[model samples]
Target: MRPRLLLVTDLGYPAAGRTYRDEDIDLAARLRADFAVAMCHPLDAAPLMAGFDLVLVRNSGPVLHYAEQYAEFRRVALESGTRVFSQLSGRADMAGKQYLLDLTAAGYPVIPTVDRVEDVGSLPDVPEYVVKPKLGADSVGLRFVPRAELGAVTGQLIQPRVPFRYEVSFYFVDHTFQYALHAPDPGRRWDLVPYEPTAADLAFAQRFVDWNTVDHGIQRVDACRTEDGDLLLVELEDLNPFLSLDRVPPGTRDAFVAALTAALLRMLA
Candidate 1:
């Protein structure tokens, strides 16, 4: 019998610059050849996942829309040993944005982050700073403020707004780099094109994959190139990262599918 996979997603989710359903649709179709794949909305995942051999979440939209349901799904999956792609535990975006502040404190080359409003001084004295909630995703609830006004909010992070030239993302499967895509126009976040990553670029992205500790799952390390020609971490997305398969070449897309298929099989093994 084929492995029964429950693919969690929100078919009707309205993403800002991309189609959430289209990507998940392609992924579900690709995965169907290897497993008995069925797609469902994220809110129904907790109750429906019991019948599947594995639960693969892709483009499920932000958990902020259904935080309680997402919590319960995580709880049941962890307690029952229900295999979840990207796993139920990840230290990066999966566990809120706290890693940003932690990594900053550890002196990792990341956008300087401080959770407490008073600690805004630790960031560079830039004209503007970014303020966002720890649990925010998809730039939701994010605002730009002057450094002096950072203390107006509590329990949020402050970082100097970098004037990035372009943004690049490194995609990986099971710690192996798959392919990369970048936003050529800095203002257009999702207008992606295939990127050829240098060895040094791969090394920068690989560090976060090593830190995540999820042995078998997809991850995307997002970084931005500063005006000084340096790259700093933007986000490490370990949970249901939207792979821009449509942007990559057909061969690269096929490779990604093959890599993901093997990872899923290994996960169930």
Candidate 2:
């Protein structure tokens, strides 16, 4: 029998400049070819998950909206030994934004981040600083403050407002590179186009993929290209990274789906 897959998503999620329903609907249609696919909102996952063989979380909106239920779902999945795509062992965004602070201190090419007032001095001196909740997603609670006001900000992650040329995202299925997309216009983030990454770009993205613990799931390594021609880590989306399938070429999209199908099979095996 084909594996019963519980695909978790928030179809009605109002993703800024993106349609959550269209992407997931397309993905679910393709996935049904290999497994018995069922769709559920993030809120329903915990109660309905046990009946399925695997739980695939995709674009479930920000977990911040349903924190308690999301926590419950995680606990149930872990304690019940239920399988999950991206696995329950991810150390990246699946956990929170703490990795930003860790990666910063370790001197990775990330936008330097600090959650404490004393550590504000460590960041680059810039005109403005970006402040957001450590546990936030989808720009929730995100704001920008002037340099003078930076030290006054408390209990949220802080970073210098980087002047970048473009933002690129490298999509992967279980550690293998699939495709990349970039927003040419910095002001229009979701307006992405196919980006041909260089060998160095792949290496830069691969470092985070290697550092992350998830062995069998989709991941998106988001990075920004600075004016000085350097790439910096933006976010390592290990949990439910939105794959902009509609934006990619048909061949690339098909290949991504094939890679995802194989990853799921491996997990179930």
Highest lDDT, which number? 2
lDDT of 1 at 79: 91
lDDT of 2: 0.93
What Cα-based lDDT does every candidate model obtain? 0.90, 0.93
lDDT value, residue 137 of candidate 1: 92
TM-scores of the models, in the order given: 0.98, 0.99
Candidate 2 TM-score, true structure as reference: 0.99
Clash count of each predicted structure: 0, 0
User: Which runs in model 2 stand beyond 4 Å of their true positions?
Assistant: none
True-structure lDDT of candidate 1: 0.90
